[model samples]
Every structure is written in structure tokens, then in C-alpha cells.
Target chain A: MSHPGADRVRDVARLAGRSARSKRRSFLAEGPQAVREALRRHRSGTPTVEQVFATDEALARHPELAEPTDGVTLRRVTADVLAAMSDTVTPQGVVAVCRMLDVGLDDVLAGSPRLIAVLCQVRDPGNAGTVLRAADSAGADAVILTHGSVDLYNPKAVRSTVGSLFHLPVVLGVPFADLAVRLREAGVAVLAADGHGDADLDALQDASAARRLAGSAPDDEGTGPRLEAPTAWLFGNEAHGLAEEELTAADARVRVPVYGAAESLNVGTAATVCLYASARAQRR
Target chain B: MSHPGADRVRDVARLAGRSARSKRRSFLAEGPQAVREALRRHRSGTPTVEQVFATDEALARHPELAEPTDGVTLRRVTADVLAAMSDTVTPQGVVAVCRMLDVGLDDVLAGSPRLIAVLCQVRDPGNAGTVLRAADSAGADAVILTHGSVDLYNPKAVRSTVGSLFHLPVVLGVPFADLAVRLREAGVAVLAADGHGDADLDALQDASAARRLAGSAPDDEGTGPRLEAPTAWLFGNEAHGLAEEELTAADARVRVPVYGAAESLNVGTAATVCLYASARAQRR
Candidate 1:
């Protein structure tokens, strides 16, 4: 791995593109954080990392990354070689070739997921990854990217996740038509996060809190959807938001109220609020 | 405005740099959304926008932008000219020269603000703008950037704010030393958003909610800082987080709980959760 222009370097770099990643069923996870997470997943019996390339300096800085893992090959490379194999200008002297980790929607449903985040037509890779990371922080059981959403394996998206991409199950390219029906069948209420929705998120949280304070069951009082129930939150594109069809498919459309003059929340910010609200309610 | 290399075009383009922006006391606001918001702010008597450069297509697409303002000079320019005057590769057909909108800290404190977000040593432009926008969405009264924080007027930051920059009052370059004292004197509790903080944000919210449900005053039972109290939330840098001094200066250090495997939340996401929590509790 001494030569920057080596065939192996070119092969790893090729994973930066979609066609190559699709053909190989693997993607490059650059930097120590991503590679470290990949090796951890591999050690946990997920077969996540096939190979890890790192410079001596990086390994020295993050010594835990040097730990041996079964079936994971670790190679020492020059910084130039690591950079040549990465999409970012600075790959932080390490890169990992990992298997595509998206699970099937059916597999996720079988787990009886308490909280799920479904991205619909979210075109920006960074936004998709940010929402996914937020979902993980909120203790979401899974995240699903519907058809037409940005590729989760895109290097920028993976980088934006800051290692959380490997922390939870992700289902990619799930069709909205089937997703809505299947989630409902799994007893998970599909709630569309819309700017102009009838149900206000704060109000719903208050209702849930009041119920908890009164020691009442979820179905004791309110006709509105309960925040404590098993639910799937659908977030839309950064620009136009959820389409009419998608909005209509949900059990109820929920809005994160804008108390200021801001016309709307960025999809990532809105999703964080929505997911954290659910996490708090369900945990209580 | 037809020539891309004209002196006027160069003058507008110079705003992309900090020296030129500071010299002129103005910054570039690219894209239609920013320009539209600048015009609105100008029309509302703030004199936010000095001049707007737009292509024929942009003016035609957003007719309201073509409306005459008292001091705003709307000049129709060629697409090439607009691009030459913008920081972005694609200026989206319009750009505006907006006055620096940051107000003095004393003026902001004079208003007895409720919820505020203070950025300490946050270096990334996008993160700064995203947090400001989140603060606005959460109905925060003002946002303060400490001495080491990123420039709020950076073009990417302004664009990232999506016009929310004009929606709220922002205090820039305020040193944490004086900021803490002034805010406390103004009757606002200063809460630092720390990952390892002793106070949990969710628990604070729960306490506030319980007090409300029991028809009690904010200071009735809990010794903790209530989310309903007028407070300033301190968010640290994207990388190393708050300095030890900033953390210790706060009346209470609050942590946004991470329920899952995510080591921590992105600063922007954490800020949103904290600000919105305060907004919800205060409103109730």
C-alpha cells in the first residue's frame, strides 16, 4: 500500500461512486471514527468491515482501532495513499471498506420497533445523515429511507452520521406505497411531519404528559394520536416537503410549531424535535 | 449591470470577504429567499437591504421582489453578473447587499428576553447559522455569539439561516465574561448545554410540566432550574465543546440525554432540543 496510484487504492476510491458501490455491495468509510465503528460492528459479528486502511499516525492516535478483529484485515498505508482512496480532501489517515448495512423493512418490523424515522424524498445526503444521527440519539429502533431519497451509502452522508450509521438498522429504498401499509399493519402509526399539519407536536406532548400525570391509559381521554404509542415518523424533502399523497397516507399529520417568524424548520431540525419528543413520551 | 467585470459587480463581490464586509458594514445575501427577506426587513423600516442584484428570470419568478422599497435599489443584472457577485457557484439568480444586522448585547438585554442561544467558540459557518435558525424556530428572543464563534455574516451562514437572520435580533462578538454577568443581571438564568452536565434537559422539562399540572409556581417545589424560566443556553464549539470557564460560569449545566448508542448529539441538534424545550415550557 505504498503507492498512491496503486490498483487497490483505485478500487477503494471507486466506491465513492454509486455504480461501483452498487456492484461491489460495499462502500468506503473514511476517517478514524467511521473505521473504528466499522471494526466494532465487525467484532460484534456483523461482518461489517472487510478491510481497514490506516496510516501509522492515525493508528497511534486511536490505539483502540488497532485491536484485532476476526475476518477484518488491517493494513498500514501512507497518508497519501489513504487520501487517494477517500472522497474527502482530508480522510484523517484512515479508511474502511464495509459491507452495505441496510436491513429489509420486514426485518425491521419484526423487531416491533418502538420508534422509527422514515425519510421520504430527502434529496440531500447531509440532511438524510443528520436526521439519521438524530434518530439514533433519540433511541430510535430503526430508520428507513424511502425510494427517491438520497443514498445512505454516499460518502458525505456516511461522514455526516459521525459513526451513528453503524449504530442502528437502516432500510434503504423502501417504496412509500408499501411502507405506509406495512407500518400500519405492524401497529406503528405513520405520522407525516408537515408544516401545515392539523396536529401540533407540542399539544400532543402536553396531552401525553397530562395523561401520565393523571395516570390514565393512552386511550383514556384524547381522540388524537398519542405520543407514547409505537410510531413511525415520516420526514420529507428539504425544499418542497412531503407530497400530497404521502401526507394523505399517514394516520395524522403533525407539525412542529414555529413560535417565531421563521416560516419553517429545516428538515433536520424538525426531525430532531419530532424524534426526541417521541423518545421522551415513550420512555415515560 | 450587464458587465460581469464591472466595478459595481466587483464591489458587491468583495462582500464575500470579511475585510470588505467589515469595511462596508454589509454582507452578501445570495439566492432569492435571502434577497426577499432582506427587502421585507428593509420595508419594515430596519433598512436591512441596501441594494439587490437580480436576473430577469429571478425577478420574474419572484414578482414581489420587484416591488419598490424606499431605499432598496433593485437592479436587473445578467446571470453572469449575479454569479460574479455571489459566493456560491449558483447564486440562484439573485443576491443582496444587506447591512450588518447584529445588535448590541446591552440593547438585547434591555428588552428582557426570555430564551436565548449563546454560541461559544463554534467555528463552522453552517453550524452557526443552523443554530440561529433553530433558535428562531423555537421562538427564542435573541442569539449571542461569543468572541471565538464563527462570523454570523459569513455568506454560507447567512444562506444557511434561510432569512431567519432578519427574523430575530443577534448579538455578535460578545465576550463570555461580560455576557454572563449582563444576562444574570437581566434576570435570565444562564444554562450551559453540556454533554456531561449534572442536570438533564428531559428531567427539567418533566419537572416544569409537573409543576404546571399541579397548578404551582415555577419556584414552588423544584430546586432545579425550570425550563419555563427566562434562560440563556450556552452551546460550545462543534469539536471540543465549551471552555471550562464558560461551563462554570453558567448557573446550571444541562445535558440533552442520549438514550441510544450515539456518543453525543450534533451541537445544532442539541441546541434545538434545548431551545424548544424552554420555548414549550415557557409558553405553557
Candidate 2:
């Protein structure tokens, strides 16, 4: 791929836009980290990467990326060509065209997911990705972005995930009405992470810890929802937070305590706390 | 103020640059939320904001901003002029010229702070601001940026803080060498948030909780550092993480457990969990 303006390069670059990505059922993952992760997923039998384009310099620097994988086409391209095919100003001389990896909500539910993160109307791609990465770190079973949430395949989001997108199952465009009912049927408690919620997260964690320390079952004492139970946390839009309907749909609205003068926690920071709290409780 | 090309407008816009900000000892806080917080700080006797420039629509939309305040110059500017005087493409019709709020490390240590977040060699502006905001959410007493860290007063960083910059004390440009000795002298344990640390954050929290539930002293059982103790958490660079010197300087290196396939947690996320764990334990 010598020409920066070639039709193939243009086609790969088109994945930067939503309509193009939707039509092709694929998105571009730029930089060595994302491309490396994509190839790893492909090697793991996920069929994630259709094609990987890299400059010689990149392949030289990351020799592991040069190893060929089945059904994944690796092409050497000029740095200019790679640049032309990437969304970021510096794509680190590598890009991968990968299949859209979001799985069905039913498939995720069938896995008996112990910890799930459902993003409700989270409009920022970076925030969505941050939450997704945090969820992966917390060992979440899955992440669901409800209808009206930012597109998980947005390049900035894919970049922000820092390869976590390839690490877990993501379900996109889920309807809140259906999701709440389905989650309850799956025996998962839907908890809304609200700023003004009556239930406090720290208190819940404390109760869970006390029970565990006393050799009692996680749910032996608390009438409220237990952090140790199968749970799905709903994080809302960065600006407006969880809507009234969404709040009411949850089993409980839980607020992360703010001991400082901050008006509220950023959605990503709050999600990390909520998800990690559940992860710790459930693991214990 | 009506002229977009006015020298005063240019001077205000120049604050987006570090040299200008350093020379003037001020920075620009754009959008309503930051301006509101700056005004609130000023009203509360901090004298943070010097001038607030807003459009008629912004003033009308936020009538509370129109309230009279001592020593604050409120000027109505044309939208074009406001844009010219702002860093963001859309400043949301308002911007404030605020004093540089970072304090000396000696003054911060003098307060005998319980929880602090120290950023060492973190270069990304957004990451710096995100950590600052997370520290605020976790109710940390102060945030310290080491010598090589990003400028917290960068326009994007200021915007990323979302008014939290005005909420707490920040110490900037402190040498790690001096900071470590001062923190030790102040009786604050310096814990490095390292990915490969021997001490697990969750385990520390569990021990803290067990002690609390058992009505025992926080430091009774463990040879390890207690999360309930007055502490300073050292967060490192996004790319290379904490240097060997930084890791060795800490009394203990603590790692936030990554329960899943995520190679590591983002520094901001790690900082949030560490700080909140300390806050919860100390408060208990």
C-alpha cells in the first residue's frame, strides 16, 4: 500500500465514521497496542482482526506483531499510507480493521454474569471507554451500553479502552425498558449509581465486609441490596446523570459518598468505585 | 469588550499559554460551572476570580451569576469577542480569569492531612486533571504534582477538572526528593500505587475493615502500613509508571488489584480506588 490516496486506504479510513462502520460491520483500531490486542484476539479464535496494516518501523519495534496469524492479513504500508488510514494524528504506524465485537445481551445474561456495568445515556465516547476499561479491571462479566449511549465503536472510545475492548464482551444499543426486566429475570439486581441516592456505597461495602468477617452469608443481614450479590450498575450521562425513570427501574439507587466539596463524581470515577466495590465483595 | 481584536481580549486569550499564565500568575476558567465555582471561592474570602466575561445570553440564563460581588469585574462581551478571549471553540459564553491556586508543600503538610494524591511525572493534561478530580471525589485533602507532571493550569486540564480545581488545595512543581522527606516528617505514610506492588489495596482495605469491625486499633495486627493512617498515595506517569526511585522512596508499594484481563488500571482509576479506600478507612 504505497499510495496514501489509494481506494483501499480510503476504505479503511472510512471506518472512522459511524455510517461507514455500521455498513461494513467493522471498525479501525489504531496504534500498536490496539492492533496487537486485535491480533491476539484473532489468534485466540475470536476472528477479531480481518486485516492489520503496519509500517516497517512499527513491525521492527514490535516484532511480536509481525508473527502471522491464521485468517488475519498483515500488510506493510508506508507511514504516510498508515497515517492516511487512521483517525488519530499519530496512529503509531499501525492500524487494524476488526469486526464489531459487541455480543448479544441474551448471550451475556446466559453466562450468569456476577458483575455487569450498564451505561445509560452516557454521551461521551471517552467516558464510555473509561468505564469499560474500569469494568474490565474490576473483572466485570460484561458491559452494556443502552440505547442513546455513545457508540462504543467510536474511534476515540476504542482508543480510550486501551485494548480492554478486546478483553471482554460488550452489548451496545440496549433498551432500558427491556434491559431492566431482563436483568431482574436473570437474578441480577440493577443498581442505579446516583448522586442523590438514599443508599450509600461505603455503608453497603462495610456491611458486606462485616458479614464476611463474621462468617455469615453475604445476604444474611442486610434487607437492602448486597454488594456481594449478582449486580448490574447503571451509570448515567455525564451531565444529567441517571434519569428518574432509570433510577426508579433499579432495585436501589446508590450514591458514592463525597466527603469533599465536589458537587458530584465524574461518571467514570464513580463507575470505577461502584464496580470495584462489587468486584471485591463478590470475590470475597 | 465588544471588539474581538482588542488588546485586552488578546491578553486574556494569551493565558492559554503556560508562559503567560506563569508570568501573570493566573489562568483562564472557561464555561459556567468553573466560573461559578471561582465566584463562589471569591465570595467565600479566597479572592480567586478577578474578572468574569460573559455574553448577555449567558448572564440571562444564569441569573445567579449576575449577582453583585465585591472586587469582581463583570463585563458583557460579544460572542465573537468572548470566543477570541477563550481557549475552547465554544466557551459556553463565559470565562473567568482566576488566580494561580497552587500552595506550598510546607503549608499543605502543616495541616497534617489524612489523605493525599501525588502525581509523579504524569505528562498528559487530561490525565492530570482527571486525577485531581478523582482525588476531590475521594475527599482527598491535597493533590501534589511532581516536577515533571503536566501543568494543571493547562486550559484542557482546567476544563477537565470541571470546577473541582477550586474545591481543594493543590501543590505543584514540588521535587520528589523534597516531597518524600517532608511527607515522612509530617507523619504521613507514602504509598506508591504501583502495578507490581507487593501490598494489595483490597487486602489492605479488608484488614482495615476487619480491625474496625472487631473494635481493634487500625494498626494493631498488621506489620504492613494501615490504610486508616494519614497517608500520601504516589501515582506515576501514564506510560512508564513510577520510577525505581519513586517506588523505593515509598514506605510501601500498593497495587490496586486487577481482577480481570486488563493489563493494568488507568492511573486515574487506580488513584480513585486508593484514595477512596484510605478515606473510608480513616473516616471509620
Candidate 3:
């Protein structure tokens, strides 16, 4: 059915805000990439997507969605209604109402994850999403958003992930201290990614490579933990980095070396480089 | 001189758009970071910053600008006037009008540059700014924007650079074909960063490292050109990557290997990784 300017449609649009999204226990997956991922996850029994709302043109573009599914309710929306339901200046023709994707912290940790990205108090929606995407690309097993992070389900953050939210486990609203303990209990080394950290990232890579060449055992140089160790990377806010307590709490603090004159690397790009370095080391 | 909603302020606000900025030969450097960078360049004789408009509160925050400068004109404005002249949702209370910062291609290429970033048809302001910041951090000598890329002077693009624009020479509006010829003649290897390229980034790194280990020479294993050579990374647009001709014209197309299911790296992040790899190789 086509809902043109209905209250129900407007209510869905209001989910873009935090309180409304919390009350509704749902979030929007805007654009083709997000909607496709939501649908794919739902069909595979994850049950993220509850409904798909699209303009006729959007549906025509995504012909594969025409095949009927058991759980998802597909609806046709008028262009006006689609506009009303959009959070962006130019709404993509498709939007999916997906259930909250964040899993329990305990559940995520229980899965024996080798790599996890912990975002602590990260404020930028775009940066948060980019980290999630980077973590997924680096084969991170899970992502955790501690208290004070931008809402995991924020439309912009969701869009930024490019559907990585659906690909991996994301645990939300966990206390950083508690999460760190759990990671330790699981034999994962918690590494704080900070600019001030004494352990250089290149040195970490070299140490891991040396260990591999020396027959799979980390040496005793005290250059911080080996990348081959099961690890959780804790990243902090944009302006103010991780609190001193947060840094102290980690098994070690590792810094991505800046080879050029730029003072510091962006949080998103730094997270990507660190994650990839770890992935490369662990895979070897 | 509080020009709350004056015609002059309105005209200045209009400079946020491309046509108006091009016509006026001035663009906005908004917020403390961007405005500071522009003024720094101006005092160093680069003459990019022409005027500064600020609220009393903004001027108080920046004590360095309290004293009058030789060239920059400072005007006090009401908060409302500052808001009128601002583009962001939250005005940082300061804005500067900067002259065109782009240099001629011939001028940039004449500097005997070792590393450069060439953007081809890149459209997103955030991505473009990010690439600028990344290139700067990687210690690139210059950045060239080929025709069809987003406006370098666009306010959003400038904001995204986080003041990196001031730190490096940026050349704009050069035709791609002419740029390729100039780069080749300059002994600068042009490498197209593509996902389907024959040369893998890891393989390239290994080859460069191997050559260095074997004593100061590039190996001829046919993987691709050595990164230590003067290199210009040509990054394509977000939506459509480099065209076949563009990719074919490069010395070789080098792909950043993806370890996870992420279809590709973001254009900005990909450019950062490529530039840093080259920077690291050259540094070695």
C-alpha cells in the first residue's frame, strides 16, 4: 500500500532522533547499500529488517527485492511521503526500518573474537561509522561503542558504515571499564590507540614480524604487545583523546607513527591503519 | 561595524557557493582552524587571507589576532551577523575571506616534487578535504585537482582539510591528459589507485622493502613501479572510479588489497593509505 503523508510515515522519520529511535526500538537504513544489507541480514535469520519502504522507481531499480520474503513487509511510498520520511537533504529512494543491531557485550565477548574495535566517547557520527567500516574491512570480529559514543543507529552513522553494521557484531552502551575486564578475561589484550602512546605502531609491526621470523614467539623488548595477540583497540574522542585512566587501563598504549609534519592522524584513518596492521600480523 | 544582515554580509555569505566565489575571487575559511591557517599564510607573504570578520567573543578567544595586521582587515560583527555570514550549523564566531589558493600546474610541477596526490573527478567536499589533510600528513609536496573534481575553494572542502590546505601547495583545474604528460616528463610515476589493478599495495610494499634490503635499488619483479620513485597517486571519484583511459595512462594501476568483505576502501581513506605507503617507502 502507498502511504502518502501518513502519521505512521512521519513517526518513522522521527526515529532519526535518539529518543524516538529508543522508544520505537528501530532505526532507518537509508540508501540502497544499507537497505540491501538489512534485507540480506534479515533473510539469513538475523531479523534486523522489519519493513522496506520505497518509491516505485526505487523498487524498479532493486528488482531482486520483488521476490517475497517471510518477515519483511514491503510498502510503496509516494515521492512526497518518501521525502517526509527522509533524514537527508536528498533522500535515497529506499529506506528500511531495521531493529536495533547492537548485541549484548557479554554475548559479543563470548564468541571468542580475535579483534574488536572499542570506540569510547566518539562524538562524530561520520567518524564512528567510518571506524565501523574500517574495522569490518580489517576483519575485526566485533565493534563496541562504550557509553557517550554517538548513537550506533544514527542515520548518518548507519549510512557511513556502508552496511558493515549488518556484517559484524556491534555491542553498544557498554561501560569501558567492564568491557576491558571482559576482554582480559577472554585473553584479549586491550590496546589504547593514542597519539601520546610510547609504543610506536611501526615498532609493533616489526616486533610481530620478528616474532614470526623467530618462530612464532614474541621477544622481550618491552615494545608493547605483539599484533598477533587477540586484541581490542580502544579509540577515544576527536579533540580530547582517551582519558589518562583509559590509557592506563589498557594492556598497552600504541601510537600510529606520523612520518610527516601533520600533528596527528584523523581518528577514523588512524583506526583503519591500526586495524589493518593487526589484521595483517594476525593473518600471517 | 556590526553589519547584522547587511547586503555586504549577504554577498559574503553567497561566497560559500562556487559561482559567487569564482566571480568574487574569494572564498570563506570558516572556524578557528581554517581562519588561523589562512592568516598564518598571509603573514608569511603568501597573501591568501584578505579579510577577517568576527564577533567580540571570537576575537577574545584568539588573542594573537587582537593586534592589527599589515594586510588583513578585521571587522567586529554582532553574533547574528557572524551567523549570517556562516555556513555551518553552529558558527564558530570567526570567518576569513581568502584569495584563491590554487597555483598553476606549471608552477607546482616546477618545484622538483617527490610525491603528489592527483584527484580526478572527485566530487564530495568531505572526501576532497580529507584527501588534502591526508596528503599533507603524508608529507606530499603538492596536490593537483584535475578538471571535473569538486571546487577546491568550496567552504565545505576547505573545512574538511582542517587547515592542511594552507600547509601544502594545491594545484587545481589541470586537465588529466596534460597532467599525465607533465608528470611523466618530470620522472614522477603516475600510479592509479584501483581495486582491480594488477599491482597489489602489499606486494608493492614488499618489493620496495626487498629492494632496499638488497641495497638501494628497485627490483624488476614486474609487480609495479617502486614507491620510492617520485610518485603521484591518481584517485578517482567516489561513485565512478578512474575511466579505462585514465587507468591505462598510468605507469601501473596499484590496488590496495582488501582482507575483509568491504567491497572497497573509501576514496579519502584509500588515498591516505596509498600516500602513506609511498611516503614510508620514500623515507626508507
Which numbered prediction scores highest in DockQ against the true structure?
1
C-alpha-based local distance difference test score of model 2: 0.92
DockQ of each: 0.90, 0.89, 0.56
lDDT of 1 by residue, B94-156 (tens): 898889988999899999899999999999999998899999999999999999888888898
Which runs in model 2 stand beyond 4 Å of their true positions? Answer: A1-5, B1-5
Q: Residue A119 deviation, candidate 2, in Å? A: 0.5
Quote the positional error of residue B158 for candidate 3 in Å. Answer: 0.9
Residue A281 C-alpha lDDT in model 2: 94
Candidate 3 interface CA RMSD, Å:
1.9
What is candidate 3's DockQ? Answer: 0.56
lDDT of 1 by residue, A37-63 (tens): 888888888889998889999989999
If scored against the real structure, what TM-score would every candidate get? 0.98, 0.98, 0.94
Model 1: interface root-mean-square deviation in Å: 0.6
Tens digits of per-residue lDDT for model 3, B1-284: 65545788888899988899989888998988788877777888888878898888988998676467778889889888888888886667888888887888778778888999999999999999988888988889999988889998887898888888898998988888767888989889999999899888877776665565556546455445889889999999999899887898899999987777677889877887788788877875
User: Which portions of model 1 miss their true places by more than 4 Å?
Assistant: A1-5, B1-5
Task: Show pairs that collide, candidate 2.
Answer: none
Give the local distance difference test score of model 3.
0.84
The prediction achieving the highest lDDT against the true structure is: 2
Tens digits of per-residue lDDT, candidate 3, A191-256, equal 999998888887777566556555644545545688988999999999898987788889988988
| DockQ measured for candidate 2 | 0.89
